[model samples]
Target: MITAQNLTKRFGAHTAVDDVSFTIKPGQVTGFLGPNGAGKSTTMRMIMGLDRPTHGSTTVNGRPFGEHTDPMRQAGALLDAKAAHPGRRAADHLRLLAATNGIARSRVDDVLELTGIASVARRRIGGFSLGMHQRLGIAATMLGDPEVLIFDEPVNGLDPEGVHWVRGFAKARAAEGRTVFISSHLMSEMAQTADHIIVLGKGRVLADAPIAQFLGGAGQERTRVRVSDATVLGSILSADGVSITQTDAESLEIAGLPPAHIARRAALENLDLHELTPLNASLEEAYLALTDDATEYRSDRTAVAA
Candidate 1:
């Protein structure tokens, strides 16, 4: 498990991460989400001991990352895929890391095969594509066979097949009772990949909960109702605190009321109904609602370019 207690980081006058606290439980894939410059990378660096926190602390198990006897075996991280020397061969790079950490050289081949990059194991890093570099980075992380894994933007340059492989790999690790914390900007992928989610904006945590709860727990339930006479049903359904949006001439998107309530209301009014569908708030919707005010950058598009 990974535990962060009031973690904070400051660079001169600017605060990058502000008193953030959260837990990444084992046997689960926890997604770390945020907009650009929202402190996701800063927090991951602090957790890996790459940067010291200005206040509070983050621990892998019960100790800081620097205090671990076998740091790589305890927690492995892929913060930057390009951290290795660009001239070195992929296999040689993994060999060097294993040598420094007293890991057996055989583990190098194991990870190379595991990450599906063994075919190009002898190729130089500079010649590898962005996707190949990502695979090589993941191979390095698995060299330690660590119980806790941290991946920052692991799918940045991956194709569809690679992304699918990563999703399955993360869940497989969690199934083995390992702590897997991944940070990404892709909400649709997170909706399918993560079991729990932590959202950050403006250097602070905005929300953290299970994926299911995070998607539906924040806003009012919306029900889409298409009636035969939306013009007549509009005034009849309009009441105090009940919001209704007319989607079309004959369709209305209703909120602040249950589907059953809308159906009963239509029945009592003797109105014909065509569609009564309950629309669940998607992850993208929930994320936008949560971070609307927290977004640091906003664009005012007053002009269009041809």
Candidate 2:
């Protein structure tokens, strides 16, 4: 498991990571999410011992990452896909890492095959494509077969098949009781891959909870109601706190009310209901709502003349 207690980092006069505390337990995939400049990379760097925290502490498997005798064998991270030497052959690079970590050379081939980059293992890193680089980075990360896996944008340049494989791979690793923590801007993939989520904004954690709880808490529940007379049903549902929007001639989307309450009120009014479906907010919607004020950069949506 990985733990961070009051972790903080600062560069010169700017604080990148604030007093952050989180526990990434084993047997689960925890997704790290945030807008740009939210200090996610800084936190990950601290966890990997690449950057020293200005205050607080972080540990991997109960100790600081650098304190581990065999750090690679305890935790593996893919912070940057271009971390390897551009001139080295992929296989040779993995072999070198294995040698330094006292890992068997045969394990390099195993990871190469596992990441589906065995065919290009003998190729120079400089000639590899971005997708190939990501795969190679993942191969290097698995060379030690560490129990804790940290991947930052593992699917950045991957194709659909590669993305699917990575999603499944992360889930599989978590299923085996390994600590899997991933940071990505892909909300859809993260929604499917993560059991829990940690959202950071402006160097502070905004939300940390199970996927369902986070989604449910981010926005009000909405329901779609289809009736014979959309106008009449909308009028009937409108109240001080309730909001109703005419989605179509025959349907109304509602909020601030439950489906059962709507159904009962419709029954009391003897209005025939065709459909009353609850609209669960998507992960993207929830994320946007939660981080709407937290985003450091905002783009204008004004239309431009051709």
Best by lDDT: 2
lDDT of 2 by residue, 1-306 (tens): 999999999899998899999999999999999999999999999999999999999999999999999988999999999998999999999999999999999999899999999999889999998889999999988988999999999999999999999999999999999999999999999999999999999999999999988987766789999887889878877899888999898899999998999999888878899999988788899998889898998777464332
Candidate 1 segments whose C-alpha is farther than 4 A from its true place: 226-235, 245-252, 266-277, 301-306
lDDT of 1 at 211: 92
Positional deviation of residue 258's Cα in model 2 after best superposition, in angstroms = 1.4
Residue-wise C-alpha lDDT for candidate 1, range 64-167, written one tens digit per residue: 99999898899989999888899999999999999999899999999998999999998999998888888898898988899999999999889999999999
Clashing pairs in model 2, backbone N/Cα/C closer than 3 A: none
Candidate 1 residue pairs in clash (backbone atoms < 3 Å): none
> How big is the positional error of residue 178 in model 1, measured in Å on the Cα after superposition?
1.3
**lDDT (CA) for every model shown?**
0.92, 0.93
